[model samples]
Target chain A: MIRPIHAIQIFLIVAVITLVGNWVGMQQINPVDAALGMLILVAMVMAGWWLARVLPVPFPPIVFVSLLGILLTMPWTPGSEWIVSHTTQVNFLATTTPVLAFAGISIGKDLDKFAELGWRIIVVALVVFTGTFLGSAVIAQAMLRLTGQI
Target chain B: MAENEVVEREFEHNWKLYGIVLILTIIGELIGVRTFQVGPGTALLLPMLYALVIGMFLGPKFVKVVSEKDMSDASPLIVLSVLILVAKLGTTIGPNVPQLIGAGPALLMQEFGNLGTLILAMPVAVLLGFKREAIGATFSNAREGALAIIGDVYGLDSPEGRGVLGVYICGTIFGAIYNGIMSGFIASLNIFHPMAIGMASGVGSASMMSAAGGAAAAAIPEAADTILTFAAASNLVTSATGLYMMIFISIPLANLYLRILTGGRE
Candidate 1:
């Protein structure tokens, strides 16, 4: 687990990067608006992290973070409209760029281990990814059609 | 050295990583979204892909800009950074709660699709000469949760553990990229509803979900919000319920499948 201070620092850094990405890529959103949105997201994540630490429950911080987001914006909540409207300025895709950037930079330490796994595991991994995706897609298609949702 | 040189160097390495990621985000965002015509289907390439590829270029084995230590330092940051994305995706669910509930059955049933990996990958892994390792690798996507499952049951030193670990590393490396490209391609094929593709994007890993969900949104821009909301809801369900599914269904089924395929052959 990352220390709370370090996690906060990283979240701040990611927020700024995401703000920049939103400003550059999404002309529909103002950078200041997006920054405020980023602030709410960071706060929720930290609050969730704190909750995870304090609560006796063993669920990961993600569960709390997600639940917090849902609760805070559930239309019936007092500030749901404001929260929803502001956060819309931060496009979801823009948020992803920084996340994947970190993922990419972190890949180096695992390269040797990955290479040692040989071509077969690599093939199997790709197959696993493909099967999971296609299988769910097929099932979802059939179910939706049956329910007349599509 | 003041206090501890190692701690000081660790701070420096982390900042360097942060700096590089910041730079990559700017460059990637500037290039922005691109789409290509691959035969009849479209390939949607977003800024995240640019950031990812360029960051890989800075890998220790590549441009050598980052050391192995720097790489390790960046790992936890990846988990931290993804929290913001998770929070963002979660917010997408609140207003759409009714729609999410409406799709509940399909959402619940679609998780079985995760089993698709075991059925398809295990036989191939066996054919390719994997032994007991096939059970771990093909059993699931082997995310952190799945790794814990394997660790608890088989211990990380076992062949099954190694298999799970190997795929976990593979996922850490290329899972997002593969999902990004494939989701866009599949969505472009126009065979399934954007909603189905959205639920399918869950796949139980955050970064991969972001990539797949983003690509699905890009493909069917008309329904982008709904697609993302569905993806987030499905992903949350998978994450919440996936461990139980693995322990009860995936592991045993994978073992049975392997046994049937190998016929007890060494």
Candidate 2:
């Protein structure tokens, strides 16, 4: 019963919320704006989940768009050079990467089951992997060829 | 009703182990982000791997162990990690907004390229005979599956859920591959100074826009202020747009392809 149209509707709703939240946050008090922005994000996520239950919408896009909207609208001070420095950016990434890596590892650990799903997962993984590389390369090469940049 | 009661009791009882793993992973991730040089692209892997390990250790029985409390505790870390990433991304954008506009089309095209890979890959998997339930299980458990876990809590572990998981997992692997290929392509174009292909791979996988922007910035820091701008813009857009595009387009495409391939077995 899950339909493709439901996914489209969910995407539209989330996109609207994201745009509205961004516009409103830009006009509001800084802290209040940040908090509201986060709230909007949570609401979008919840909405996606609810929609999935009622319909067949996928969840990643809703989460991604909402996060993107919030990132776009977050308050940033103009004069804080130190905060915006490359070193600081590097530092911030340093603190964040382990968590992501750990998540990857955790997911990889489940590969055994994914493995048990038989060669299907592996075959699919290889096919998806090969297809992506080949597809992107083909497009890139074509674009380069057209531009005479190759 | 009996099945629901059993699942409920099991979830409540095993909640602590889940909490412990979630907390340790968050702490590890926080430390890694703050003190080390791990980027967002790389950082996500940790929790993913941790969950996989936990899944393997706990096996099928522990599926219920990943409870609401675990997700609630883990949510803050996820938010914070992304926030730090955005903060870095914002700094990259603050300096060069105008250039981003000029390069917007190419960047958008790059995104579409990423989407193209997913569209191509999903059907091939389905047509090749990957089970719908397996797809659902994988998607439901991956990062986005945080919500699906909630569905599990409510005893909504149906065929549809499994299908979602399967499709999502397939999409994730494709997403990674797209990053790798695009990163390499960008390097070869010499649109900016080049880094080693391995570094490009890491960057491609690490922070798509940043890696792209960083590479561009490195190549011609002055003439391509626009490159830096595009990099920053693309980073955020890639993350957000990429996710949305996958959900709305890729999932259905996979399902449709599945129907076509399997004669509607799914």
Candidate 3:
């Protein structure tokens, strides 16, 4: 659902959270501010929900949120250390585990619909992987060589 | 009662659905948490894969307490998880930022590499007998953003829609699992820079991106931040440009192939 307006709002919410979370990580969140921290997480979910709306350009909400997160925590900023430190509080694994489980179930529900698509999926998946691998490897190797990073 | 109301009522109290998904999530977390040392510096665990496997096991054939309609809520839940992961990924980057000047060319190569996937996929799909629509769909995985392209330009009822939907479905099931494994394998090879592979991993979904990032970070702890930064940056560029590129650049090229393969009928 992440249309332009929604994307802006969602990004703002996460921007604030990244700002506060990083600050807390660097210092300490008093009991009063803890409520604000909880609110930020909730706002983030609501903002994430806006992502369900689909953007005009087809970009996912993750890109916007990440970009905003990065902007809020720029290393050279006045106090970027807090943002980086609290970044771990997001607990990516704990969150993704459930999401993946739900994703599996969502897929299973469409098994009948999917079986009709035939076997080409296997070949296509492998091809996509190979193409990306070769393309990335060739470019990476060349870039490293050109830059003398390798 | 009307059919709509009946359906709404069913959805109103799908407690069993939540319970089942909760159990599945727990199962997945337990497995994802069980990392084993593969080497002095490497470790492995496939939480996403494990969750998917257990979920597939709970399908109608085995467990009917939950219906597709009930699990409908999973969509937003999944998106939220992806959001959290992406935001967290952002944090890992901002500070440990590498030489920005170096990332410029590397990012370009990775983007082309992602587009290269479409170039490679289209021919194989056409060889296997897909037409303009299916071929187009197969050319791009069309996971989250690409789906919009398929729906807008090529009606979902078109062959392309069906093709992209199929690819999207398969990707949902396997993209993350494979992307994670690919990262670990690529990292293990010690050939490409962890920075480069991180960018490659960004071509897939958020979870896939995280898995790829995780593999690189685990393999080379020192370069962990650099790996994540490159992966996020490359992903941002790919997604932002992918829609236009898919429409303006890749589609026309695919159509050329379609014409050649179909004897100019395309």
Candidate 4:
């Protein structure tokens, strides 16, 4: 079984690979860093897949962290600024817009199911949402008062 | 063997649905942004909602229809999309490190600040008798809505994809609430500082920050620096505490409330 320590090891390995790839690629072709970044991402995915299969624990957080780090950091890496600027805009649109659309569509699709549950789910969602909002606000206000921000 | 085959086939079938959803999501995003001046993140809400609606319509059949491969393929795309969005946003907003540090402690504290309230609220929600599947469906649907487009684009449709979607939605909602309340409270302090307002909103969501900024601007236009400072600080705090708060507090509270309302049906 893969231990948490193993997950850490895998993360370190991925990071090292990315760092070395970035350094070497920076000295060569312009697109090399982006290519290396993609490679690191793919490697992280593979690591996650493997860890999920072999590990007895829930899943490796490191794999996700490694992949996420590489994906976010890729734009800043040497030789990839142009792609980063152009694609970054597209990338945000690609990621967040879909999620929002999906939420709306999914909720709309489940209208009937939600209907069966009727006011219960609505009430619950509203209550939880409101509770969270109110709770956070109160806590924040108190904190600000204490901190003299108020 | 037959059951295994069935599962595999089901997984494959789900991927096909996801593909269609993906294309629709892209179209929706393009149209929304181009036509409405809505940002990509805001535009994404539609496609995600649509997919959840479809998934619900598909019902239990969804389980059989979605294959493991379909789910697996969808996750990476979602991750990619998130990375892209963050990078783009970083550029637009520029770096605001001090704001982040200043707000970080309070934001983090707020994550656990309402433990008693959550615990109290869960039992109340449970006693009211809520449905588990409904709650699960809402949670699941909310997640699917957010990631459906990205998943579709990248051909990801795995359990992992679903997990990411779920986490993202919950995190956003949690962050929004935390930041919103904090900002409102801060405003009440009459500090008249945009930095405080921005920090509060930043710890929540961009939308919240925008709303806070508008209010601050309307009230006092000259304090733009304070507003900018607040936004920067709050944004950092939001990013730093977003995931941590969601995992530790939001999900558990939701689940706890779900269980109580459903009478342990889940």
lDDT against the true structure, each candidate: 0.78, 0.38, 0.57, 0.40
The candidate that wins on DockQ is 1
TM-score of 3: 0.57
Better of 1 and 2 by TM-score: 1
Off by over 4 Å in 2: A1-115, A140-150, B1-18, B21-48, B59-100, B133-204, B207-237
* Model 2 agreement with the true structure over B9-99: per-residue lDDT tens digits: 3222223533444444444433322112233223123323333244333322355544444333232223222333333333444443343
Error of 1 at B40 (Å): 2.2
Q: Cα lDDT of model 4 overall? A: 0.40
When sorted by DockQ, best at the front, the candidate numbers are 1, 3, 4, 2
- Candidate 4 lDDT, tens digit per residue, B14-53? 3363444454454443333221223222222333333333
| Tens-digit lDDT track of model 1 for B32-76 | 877665543444567877887677668767899888766666655
What's the count of clashing pairs in each model shown?
0, 49, 7, 55
On TM-score, the candidate that comes out on top is 1
The stretch of ten residues in a row with the least summed lDDT in candidate 3 chain B is B1-10
- Inter-residue clash pairs, candidate 1: none
Docking class of 1: acceptable
Model 4 stretches with alpha carbons more than 4 Å out: A1-57, A60-67, A70-89, A96-111, A115-130, A145-150, B1-15, B34-104, B113-129, B133-198, B216-228, B256-266
Where in model 1 is the C-alpha error above 4 Å? A112-126, A133-150, B1-13, B104-107, B125-266
Against the true structure, what is every candidate's RMSD? 7.6, 11.0, 8.6, 9.7
Best-fitting candidate, scored by lDDT: 1
